[model samples]
Target: MKHNELKTKNELQEKSLFDKTVGRRSFLQYAGAGAAGIALVAAGCKKDRGYENPVMGGATLDFKDDFGVLNYAYALEQLEAAFYVKVASAPPASFTAAQKAYFQDIQFHEIAHREFFKAALSTAAIGSLEVDFSKIDFTSATSVLSTAMTFEDLGVAAYNGAGPRIKDGGYLLLAGKIVSVEARHAAYIRDLISNGSFADLNSLSAFGSNNAGGLDGALTPDKVLPLAQPFIKTKISAINL
Candidate 1:
């Protein structure tokens, strides 16, 4: 990464909206709702065994190179963009105006991320994946924010784990930029749901020991897919990943 680019990313992180204090109303927006209790449809998904074998059956991430990783990221961006678009179309009745506006901003960011990967991958990009959000309750603020938190956290982990696997520095740089935005989204959503819990032990423990080192979590493709599979209806045949 260029020195200026690095400095810009650092500055963005330093000025992250997650640093703001939450108003009591925003903190208790969904007083009786249990965000943790919202579950995804993981019934038929298989546990990820290894990278060599193709676990998902439909869209082909069949490349044995960095294209495979980029396509994987593209697929995830598709899911997230689709999700935010859905939420923005009809946000929960209880959401404050500011909350709704922030979600719209997030929607734009996810779409831009999705388009960047699609354009970068060009012909190698996998077909747009179908999403299954049947398990999410979009009408409830707690459910929507909880699912958003899940996606942003997963996105950050996916990028962190895949970064070391890319052979090209340019691609790595792109991933770094996108992942930092994702981390910001994760932190903001976490704070919205529960004030000051953005980098708490509970969040860190979910993705292993990033907490011990005071870093964000990372998860290999093998571990990320099965958890993601529930929300993604399109089968991502990730082979040689």
Candidate 2:
């Protein structure tokens, strides 16, 4: 929780726009032409678990050194970017113009985050992973925003939790800088969905705690995998610890 400020409970009501009967054609029309492109299809395809792990398995990521940590951040950025991309693409059935623009800006921000991590990681950056939006079932506004909120909040916690684990101060600094920005993003989205409820204790952080003012649950890599599993195509068997 950001503390000392929050929206009244009565003002925090927002509706979700999901219904099984919704048609893609009408939704596309609502989303506008910029999102109708088929290129997003190359992002993912289903796979059999087989002998090799579907998620690249392991306790660590691939880069091995400082690069590995950077790639880890990069990987997370990819997930966030992909989620926002879809939100901007299909849009909610009853989305307002302002809401739509906010989502679109988030899409750009996620892409920028992804690219920035890649640029910083340099050669250590992993190849782009395929995204399986099929698993998301973004059929309505609630589905889209709630899922995004989860991921965005997860991102904030992940960075915060990972900060202390990092050995290099430079890398730590980068993570610190970026995570603050991510927290801002999280707060904005939360507010968009609910007036002034951005950093409420339930999610924004634990009550009666000093630094626990952002989010209560900070997902470790293991917990994150399952929520993210369906959307990610590449195996993530850990390589670097």
Q: Which has the greatest TM-score?
A: 1
Q: Give the Å error, residue 108, model 2.
A: 1.4
Give the root-mean-square deviation of each candidate in angstroms: 13.2, 15.3
Per-residue CA lDDT of model 2 for 60-115, tens digit only, reads 47534555666677778887877877777778878899888777766655564565
TM-score to true structure, per model: 0.75, 0.66
Worst ten in a row by lDDT for model 1: 37-46
Scored by CA lDDT, what does every candidate get?
Answer: 0.69, 0.57
lDDT by residue (82-137, candidate 1, tens digit) is 89878977999999998987787676566556655655555556776768999999
lDDT of model 1, residue 189:
95
Residue 69 error, candidate 2, Å: 1.5
Q: How many backbone clashes does every candidate have?
A: 0, 16
